[model samples]
Target chain A: MEGSQYRGYGMILLGAVVSITIIRLAYVLYWIGRPLRPMPKHLSTLIVLGSGGHTAEMLRLVNVLQKDRFVPRFYIAAGTDNMSLQKARVLEDSLLENKGIGNKDIEKLAYFEQIYRSREVGQSYITSIYTTILAIVHALWLMLKFRPEVIICNGPGTCIPICLVAFILKVIGVRWSSIFYIESIARVRRLSLSGLLLYKLHLADQFYVQWPQLQRKYPRAHYVGCVM
Target chain B: MEMSGRHQSPKTENQMVFVTVGSTFFDALVKSVDSQQVKDELRKRGYTNLLIQMGRGFSIPSKSSGEDGSLAVDYFTFSPSIADYMRSASLIISHAGSGSIFETLRLGKPLIVVANEDLMDNHQIELAEVLADKKHLFCATPQTLHQTIRTMDLGSLLPYPPGEALPIAKLMNRSQNRARSSRSLLSPPRHFCSNNSPFFFVDVGFTVQQGRTGDSFLGISFSGCVLLLHTARPRLWILLLHLFQYISS
Candidate 1:
């Protein structure tokens, strides 16, 4: 009787383990295909601006967005990029002027932050690993504090850490930081390094490409037709 | 009367030719455009001014200003308003950066894009080639820039349509409509906090400095792991309990 009872307990344990595994898999699948939940009246947006062409392209996209909807915009740039932040400020000023928003409302509506670059232009790979981790930690801090609903970025090294943290938030059921990745117009034939990482890893919810060749090459990416 | 009027006019027009390498150094582009052959080509095309915005490049053109027979040449390290120069110029020769190329294109100025071969991955060339194929601009390497300048016909170029972001905006609106519920893990603590901005008080400097110490680094990582575990417990337990009931049944 004791032996049979032990066998019964063991069978129950095995069944429990198997069922848990199957259920967990099913939950994940459901999460992936989960229907859109109703959003708040206004979304908190985080815009990651890169240097030069990346900034120009991203700002052009930002310029077209309805300001009233994506309120309390948070702009993040690489710490070393002096010009990009200045450019963003210019854009913000223009936006403020166009809308005739008062100076007192600036702090509430728009905030600017900078995150350290994971790797500089010439940094070696060994050192880059350490810096990249630091960047992720920094990005995590920012994401937690801001808790933005939307994260938009074009191809930039800085975007990698920020987007990675946002992806983690989604997976761990922390926040639904919907990531929008727009490939640069300069990339006609192939995706840039950042674009390739986000595309292959499925980090971005909506990946847009300007050139059809790139879209054909990466079937999952949407062809948006020359957004610059 | 047209031939006599042309003869009566000054030999050189007040037209300017702007050459830029964008934000980074492109010594080859600056050096190539500085050559007497290229200057003579520009002067022959009725351009009397050649302005070069050579960014971080050590190569300054041999001619500083206009000499007796040569066009007026000027050089600057960088400029705040490059568009101003593009607006005034009859012709523009710029590095194959999408910013400068599109800026020039949007202004309806003729452009010759010189692709920097040294850039790794060299995606700039593809944009240049595509634009050239569309007859929107001319494309050339540093070696062929002089030839491109000599042969490029400004009239043959077509104007690029004004860029539109309406489609992207629409897609983004749709995505926002489909966003997940706000009661996720991070939302509760934010609501609990008194201040509008919760979790804003962090000593980033001290935390970053702790990375150098082996013990502290481990401690931080451990704490981070623990935090993740604590927060994810609710969802984890619910799923496990549901599965356990299903299995027994």
Candidate 2:
């Protein structure tokens, strides 16, 4: 009798779990029906940052953003050695070969935003300080020239440091800001120093994490399933 | 999908061709032949509406191949020509580079992204894997390249999954619909919560830091364009109670 009772409990638990999944799926479908409200057809342009696999993800996001009336411009941030900028440019060539995207085809701009580091151990502090100041200058350029409503970091590279400058700008006067992650969010500990930096900069404006395991570390991070 | 080596006639509307000669991982030998092989195969399979751009770092050098007996391909040394082709393609075949992925997806065009491991630490292979996992692209290996194209069906692979699409669409739509939108940055979130919800409805901002200095400039000798950085800032938003209740019950 006890065995049978235990079996019944197990069956009940499994049924509950299954039902919840179905219902949640239904709610998600419903919510999606609201239609993704588009941002202003323009913002300083949603420049996508990337190095390799991540670069593709960011670029794809840029494409999706472009479909709507409010399409953002494309920009690539150079990584570590600021080398990503040149590598990313190859992608533009790749665009020509595969997708057939031409520089003149869309109202877009492509350039590299290199990130620098100080050589001397002593210069590290000074490097950070200078980086901070340069970030501020770049922020001002973005604001004054291509003014974006919200900044979307598809690739983390320059996005992290730039976020600091943006943060400073926001504190002083800028109003809109946000940072998104294109990878999993189950564990913050595993995130690169840059990922952690971005996570902190936005402080919660909005994060589009890709996995559940990451949630344990980023309690506030939302699992959008996949941002690719 | 009628393809042509020659540009389509002007009367054609809603027409596009995919010219996917993926990136060559610094390969002088493989790249020399990849383009012509693709073009010939695609033509035989009735893919007449195709335009192609050879992979990156391959330029004026290949055209000279006509002088070589081993290099049977009529390679074009032209790199810039791809820009025109990109504008013409309704469908795109690309190497697994982030820029190609971004361009195609943003254009809302159908795509097939091939992997070129030689580019960066076999990163393209992994990149293709992630995109395939998300159902955003079609992919294949070199051995099966011809077969995949011969029996290609884009309808099934598209449209991208909603979870991914919704958030992106929301941002674009919000940007378009709101005339009040102006130059301003949204504040990073202050609270934290992790659950699958439509909260992706809000926008996630970006930052661009320039790494220019005596060291980076002297060490690298080039400015990096597409840098991948991370943000550890915590953004918190309330979870959809509906998900909790729905999952628990």
Candidate 3:
């Protein structure tokens, strides 16, 4: 009688694990299998900016975007980085001027948010584990708050947590954000750490490489011919 | 200020060579450019003025004119309007940061990008080499910079192709409209949400118009076209269903 009871308990536990795995797999397939369709007139976009070079490259990309279509833009940067946010504002002000609009109305069409940095340059790996959690929590809060329809980012360590949160939201059916990751032009022969993770984990919807050799190494990434 | 004291009055026809290491300290590049050999090469190339943005480097060269006072030497740690300096330059020798490289290239200035070898990641060298191979800019290391300056033909470098973002924008738009699922029966739905709604609306409508809930939502043009309405809240779904039925009847 004791043996029979133990077997029954084990079977129930096994069954529970199997069913949960199947459901999770279904959700993954459901989201990943989505087909392309016609875009709407306007989309809420999230642009993740980083310090120095990353911000410069991203702004160059933003400069060429269709202004009217990608409205209500949100620019996310690391909390420690003031320069990127300042640069973004300058770009926004210039964009407003081009549209013949006043600077006072800049907040209505564009929003800026700062997320905690997961790890600082040259930070020890052990301590970074703790900071990484903090960054993820902050990212989750921002993701839930905005739930943007489109997300575009270049190679930035700060972008990793936000993109991860976006993927989690998709899994839970909270929001389906299309993630676009453009490898930094500085990364000619190999992808950066952030780019490698997103590519390996399939977090980015579309991965673009500026160099053709990098595309050959990572077949999944699209070679867009030096998007600088 | 010393910055103003070191400067001499500029001649309209004077050609200036701008050396920048951006926001980082690159003592090697600064020292190389400050060396006598490099100064003589610039003079040979007909450059009359040398302006160096040294960043945080330790090797600050003393401000002194050349033997003939034909070549003026000036150095500053940082500048807010570096682009103005770049614009007036006849030649630019910049560090291999994409920001500095592209900025100089777009200005159509003759550039020689020097890669910092001390940095752990040497990937920046690849960018410099590729651009050099295309004849867009000359590439050199700190040790070889003088050689590059002496031998590089500014006229041989071609203009970098202007960057285009339209392809990425088109890709983003196409990705935004992707269908919700693989099932043919479950076709793509038009998303409807506004600041007022706590949750986004993924309504399966052949033609979707907003209801009374949010001003940003589509106004009701045809009531019967919405086949399904999916929302994060069940209460909102029932309310929307009732409103749709009320409009149709």
Candidate 4:
């Protein structure tokens, strides 16, 4: 009797595990396969500004995005700096590798990184001068090359330079805009949602909030949840 | 321009396509699938009129990402023909890339934007979000991307115009009218910023730092690129060095 009862319990445990696995798989399928807006007629180009996981996710969505719209040559990256988004960037790289892509074909690469500061000489400005100059030079090079249309940003630091470049492009008759993700949930990793929210306002073209409290506080924010 | 009716052939009637953005992901799917299956599926899907901008550097994909829906793909290198594709396409789904978006927008056609979170901390998301909120464009995510496509509303969408093209032309004309402000006389920007004027990138106004001998050295004002009362030695040195390099190189 004891042996039979033990077997019955084991079977129940197995059934529970199976059920959970199946449910999770179903959710994944539903999320990935469900459809919505028809792909708009393609723009001259849609430049996805960053690289890595978010980029990978963006790429995954393209399958469905291409239905009515034309899929143009797109950049699949998480962000410029690979260290922060190591995993997602790696996946993007892997996806690229799977396709056997080698290098981007451009005639030349501009290595100039320039930073312009006012005539004032402050400690913070002086300390960061070299790095700032490098960034400017790089920005100018990119400006001359990848004249983008819209710029989307999750944070201000790196995106700012790209924007400066994009703005230059705009000045020269290019069209562009910017967006922000408001990623406090993952952006401030290890920090509690409340604690991380302590900083300044979450700014963006459109703001995405994860928690209800945050949504209440920032009335204008859209609650997209933690898509990551 | 004249209107042309749909051709007798379904292939002829379909729109010719060009992908000026998002090759990174499409290439992966292309590599992972069997070429034969990809061609078959693409044909079946009625995508007889399609072009993938591989940009000359082609990458191959591994087996897994394409295991299920592996077949029905095509990839091509980006070439001058892309200009033609841009002209031909009825739709252009791009990566919100600055270059591609501007050209398409200047054309004043339709557009769909996908911000790449990969570039710099997902700034692209902000770009798409802002444009979408402004009712200038549409945005999507990988998971919900297909849905965005299936239900995409094209009526409200419009292409962006080239940024402030005519005004700057006028500014250039006015600057040309002023002899001192020729392209060569441009000093650093601080002098203009301090004066509370919208400054152009090529605005040339700098303080000439003269010494005891009344020897004048042209200097670029660094402080906010504005309010140039005096000149610093460092910029003078840089100017000299730049000249030296220019002549030597």
Candidate 5:
């Protein structure tokens, strides 16, 4: 009787393991041949801005995006980052002027909607844990409120929480926002920590690398030539 | 006092050399530049201004009392817009931080990258070597910095093409088309949680079961969920895991 009880426990555990494996495999296979969709006519975009270089690279990419199409651009940056906010404001004004949308009409055009500040990566593991939780709460609230159709970011520590929030939203069927991750140009050989996470988790619907070699290294990642 | 020195001299077109150590203090890089030897070298090269952004916990370069004080060396703890200084400068000398390197490259400025070998990982060294190999930027050590800067021909440095949209746009277009068709076939119910509260949990569980196929899936989901929950209450689970491991041990 004792031996049979042990065996029963083992079988249940085995069954649980097997079931989970099958489910994951099915999901992967289903996504493997998924068809592409055309760029939506109007997209509420959430651009996760990193401090310094990440912000600069994302801004450069944002410059090329059809401004009129990606309306009501929302920016997320680390709480401490004033530079990115300043830069985004400057970019917004210039973008508006370039689109021939005057100061008065800026309310109607593709304007910088709002800037949300998430927790920056902390130095210590314990502090980082606390900050990360705060960041996620902030991110979840933003994701729900913004209800963005598309999300775009270059790899930054702060992007992780926001991306994870998006992933959860997708998983829970809250929203079907497409995540587009553009790996930083500097990451010629390998993906940054955030990039690696998004790639591994299948969080990014579209993952792009700046270098051809990186594309070869990670077959899933598309080699998009020099998006700065 | 230094403000007066800079403004007073409008006649001389001071070839500015911006030496930035980024947010981290690199005493080695700072000390190398602060040396009398480097000072003389810059003077010889006709670089009149040396703006050093010494970030955190580094000794300031001692002011030199030389015959020709034309090399107006200025120090700042930090700047919100280092790019402004970078753009105006003739040449940029920076630590091998990706931020500094790319910003310089983006601005189309000739850059000399000094890798901090003392970093825990040699990733910066690797990055510097790769970038140097591509001729996108010049790499140098403290020993070789003076020589690298002296020999650097700005004209010969490879121009970093401003970011192009075609490659990314094409991939995005392809991915979008694929996503659209996939959505049509396998669209999740619009309100899975709203209509069925208790069933939503069961459905999520079922979704996990359906997706899993091998032993790896269990491991992956276990770790992945922990990672996902890491943003929520990582410390609690971590402590519990530690206790479990301790008791088992």
Candidate 6:
């Protein structure tokens, strides 16, 4: 009788473990394969602005966004890149002026956040590893505070960490934020390093390529036709 | 017309050649540009001024001031507004960085991109190859830089068409509508935090020190009422249990 009771207990424990494992797997699959809902109107959006070309491309995209729909917009750039910050501010001022909005309202509309510079495209491996780790930690903090509903980025090394954080938040059942990855127009023949990562990991909700050839190569990627 | 013609004279005009190595130290690029052969070639072409924005690279042109009015080379460690220099430049030679390439293209200036082979992953070579294939710019190595510069057909190169700025608002609306109607099941989650009350916050600090080593440090801190909530009330435990159940389900 005692042996039978022990076996029964073992079976119960085994069943519990199996069920838990299945549940976790199912949760992951649901997140990975769920239907995309329409982006809610009046989104608190976060835009990651990389240095130089990345910044210019992002600014061009931002200039066309319905500013009223993306209320309280937040911009993230490298801490060392004063030029990018200045450019963002200048763009904002010009945008406001075009809308007939005064300078006094600028403070109320947008906020610029700075994170540590990630490894540049041609930087050494060891140094890049260290900087990438730092960027991930900083990106996590930004995500937690900003609580952005929609995050958009073009192909830049800096976007990788932030996208990873968004992916993590989704896995842990904190749903609400979506990442949109747009490959740069310069990437005509192949996807950039960051673009490849987001694609392989299934981190981005919607992935776009500027060229039609790329879209044909990666059937999953949408061809948005050069949004530089 | 006479005044304009005099102003445009090759001897009186200073044709600026801007050499930029971007933020990283590219000693090879600096060395190639400062070579005796390249200098002689520049003088032959009537290029009077060479303005170099040498980043962390230590090499300075040996003949800084042109002897017998050959070529006057001026270099600075770095510049905040290299655009000003680019605007005045008749030709640009730079390390194969995307930023430098894009900026030069935007200004419709003739350019030669020198690949830094020592860089990790051979990215510069790849970019240079693409740009060269497009006929947007010339690609050169340190050994071939002089020859490439001498033989480059600037008139035959294609002008890069500037991309039109996208109208994001209209695109966003169209995308949203498409997403809503589509049966595709791969959308990102919409919310992460369930509680309306602010329970967590994060602080970040970063510093970048400029030098050959280029040391950078990042600090992050997480603080808020979440920890206090765990201890403050017995009812919180039940709520937490329910929340976990909700998430798992």
Best by TM-score: 3
- Model 5 bad stretches (over 4 Å): A1-29, A32-40, A102-122, B1-13, B69-72, B79-84, B106-108, B125-127, B150-156, B182-249
Pairs clashing in candidate 1? none
CAPRI-style class, candidate 6: acceptable
Superior by lDDT: candidate 5 or candidate 6:
6
Query: Which stretch of 10 consecutive residues in model 5 chain B shows the poorest summed lDDT?
Result: B215-224
Q: Return the top candidate by DockQ.
A: 3
Measured against the native two-chain assembly using Cα atoms, what DockQ does each of the candidate structures obtain, in the order listed? 0.32, 0.11, 0.35, 0.02, 0.24, 0.23
| Model 3 misplacement above 4 A | A1-18, A33-41, A101-105, B1-12, B178-249
Candidate 1 has an lDDT of: 0.77
lDDT of 6 by residue, B6-114 (tens): 1134667778899999977888988888888898877766688898888888777664777578788888888888999998988899888767887898888888999
True contacts kept of each: 0.57, 0.21, 0.46, 0.00, 0.42, 0.30
Rate residue A87 of model 2 by lDDT.
Answer: 50
Candidate 2 stretches with Cα past 4 Å from truth are A1-152, A164-193, A200-205, A210-219, A224-228, B1-40, B48-51, B59-91, B105-110, B121-127, B133-136, B142-144, B150-156, B161-249
True contacts kept of 1: 0.57
The alpha-carbon RMSD values of the candidates against the true structure, listed in the order shown, are: 11.1, 20.9, 8.6, 24.3, 12.0, 12.5
TM-score of each: 0.79, 0.41, 0.80, 0.33, 0.72, 0.74
Per-residue lDDT of model 4, residues A54-153, tens digit only: 3433333332222222222223122234433443334445644655665452112111122232121233666576756666566666544443322333
Candidate 1, residue B161: Cα displacement in angstroms equals: 0.8
Q: Which regions of candidate 6 deviate over 4 angstroms?
A: A1-35, A116-137, A184-190, A210-217, A224-228, B1-11, B165-173, B179-249
Clashing pairs in 6: A34-B185, A174-B192, A175-B191, A176-B189, A176-B190, A176-B191
Ten-residue region with minimum lDDT total, candidate 2 chain B: B217-226
Tell me the spans in candidate 4 whose CA falls farther than 4 Å from its real position: A1-228, B1-12, B22-47, B55-73, B134-136, B159-162, B168-249
Give the C-alpha interface root-mean-square deviation per candidate: 6.8, 15.8, 6.6, 23.6, 6.3, 8.3
- Candidate 2 overall Cα lDDT vs. reference? 0.47
lDDT of 1 by residue, A71-103 (tens): 889999999988888888888888888889877
- The candidate, 1 or 2, that scores higher on DockQ is 1
lDDT tens per residue, model 5, B130-154: 7788788899998888887677665
| lDDT (Cα, tens digit) per residue for candidate 3, span B1-249 | 121211223444687999999888899999999898888888876778899999998999768775575578999999999999999988899999988999998998889999999998678888889889999999998898889888877667788897776676666556665654433333323333222245333222332334467422322211112233433454555467556544443
Identify the runs in model 1 with alpha carbons over 4 angstroms from their true place: A1-35, B1-12, B178-249
- Comparing 3 and 4 on lDDT, the stronger one: 3
Return the candidate ranking by DockQ, descending. Answer: 3, 1, 5, 6, 2, 4
Q: What is the C-alpha RMSD, rounded to one decimal, of candidate 3?
A: 8.6
Per residue, candidate 3 scores C-alpha lDDT tens digits across A5-103 of 999999999997787556654645445524333456777889999888889888888887877888889999999889898999899998898889886
